[model samples]
Target: MNPILDAFWYILPAYFANSSPVVLGGGTPIDMGKKWRDGRRIFGDGKTWRGFFGGLAVGTSIGVVQHLILPSYYGSLRIAVEVAFLLSLGTLIGDLIGSFIKRRLNLPRGYPAVGLDQWGFLISALCFAYPVRTIPTGEVLFLLVVTPIIHWLANVFAYKMKWKSVPW
Candidate 1:
């Protein structure tokens, strides 16, 4: 397989998990409208139960589909699903952490923190899946360099489509 395609395919589930939330998330903020000791919203309205779970579902489903379609390429279905689950879980965890830090810094929901917004999910996804299945150093580096650019393009596209209020 081409290295670029392989790396992209490996990270596809995490990408879907990270992006699904934006398109399918809303209602019942995960923090439940509570404020932290600093009198700021815990995770704000951006982090919601629906989005989190929805992302998990979407990402896992992508893995399942991949397993069904490409078992030989991805080892076993169990392994495929497991890695996808970890990546999806890690992506959301990282996003939540980023959002929490943003809230603490008084950055609004739509406000972009360059590194946090761009790399947090990808880094977290890699961390989670790395133990389960070690990615080649080259692939990891490829993802690290490409993700932010992809993220930027995706955000700009979303903004142009009016799905997002601002382009990051």
Candidate 2:
């Protein structure tokens, strides 16, 4: 099996986990409309419990399907599910963290933050994936380089489709 292909396969959960929230967002903000000490919304309206859990479910479900249908490639059910959960969870956490940091910097919701927006979730997802699944060095490098472009392109597509407020 090609290691780069495996890396791409491994990060799918994180990819979906990061993107699903945009489509599945709204409702009560995770911060519940509270203001932080700095007079900023904790996570803003964009970060909602619905989007968070929904993204996790969507990403993990994709991983489960991949594991079930392609066991040889994805590995055992337990490991796949576990890693999927970790990756999904990590992805969401990373997004939340990014939002928090951006809020601290007074960046409004949907505003682009360059590297933080592009690589944060992927980095967090990789952190979770490292313990349970071994990603080849080449594949990790591949993901690091390709994911940002994919992220940017996806955002552009979403912006064109009116699903997102910004092109970034």
Candidate 3:
């Protein structure tokens, strides 16, 4: 597959794998805020054990897949587990940090940060992987800028299709 197209295709799945945990229902910010608050605990009623575990599962799975598919780009199989761990943990951590910021700002959950949430985890994942493997700073900035636009557009269309409850 063409490299650009391949990256484009993978972008959404990667974003989803990272951000899908914060679901919005009834298209209401308050409901999402409640859910978000409940989700803050180690295990609680909001984010849910399911969503946390699911995010970890999906994030790591994608890392493993990336390792397997592009060993050259990632690293040896031996490092794959470590890479997956970093990606999963870092992705979640990014969201957690974002949630913290949102809370401090009283933004409310499901309120949407425009593109920040969509791009935050991706940037965090890449940065977390930096010690293990290096990527150009330019590339990092590219993802920060480009991924959100792609994510925003995708969410808009998905909401229009009723696949998603809100468009951010």
Winning model by lDDT:
1
Q: Per-residue lDDT for 1-168 in model 2, tens only? A: 677778778898899999998899788899999988999988898999999999999999988988987898755888888889899999999999999999999998889898898789988988977798858777888988998899999999989989898898
Decide which is better by TM-score, 1 or 3.
1
Query: What stretches of model 1 exceed 4 Å from their correct place?
Result: none
Candidate 1 Cα lDDT to native? 0.91
Per-residue alpha-carbon lDDT of candidate 3 for residues 1-168, written as tens digits (9 for 90 to 100): 454544443343346556555443123222244434435422122344456667777766766677677776544765765666676667767766666667656665556885567867786776676687544555556677677777678678778876567786
How accurate locally is residue 26 in candidate 1, as Cα lDDT from 0 to 100? Answer: 92
Per-prediction TM-score to the true structure, in the order listed: 0.95, 0.95, 0.69
List the candidate numbers ranked by lDDT, top first.
1, 2, 3
Name model 2 segments beyond 4 Å from true.
Answer: none
Q: Which lDDT value does model 2 have at 68?
A: 80
What are the Cα lDDT values of the candidates? Answer: 0.91, 0.88, 0.60
lDDT of residue 72 for candidate 3: 67
The positional error of residue 49 in candidate 3, measured at the CA in angstroms, is 2.6
lDDT of 1 by residue, 72-144 (tens): 7679988988999999999999999999999999998889898998889999999999888757889989998
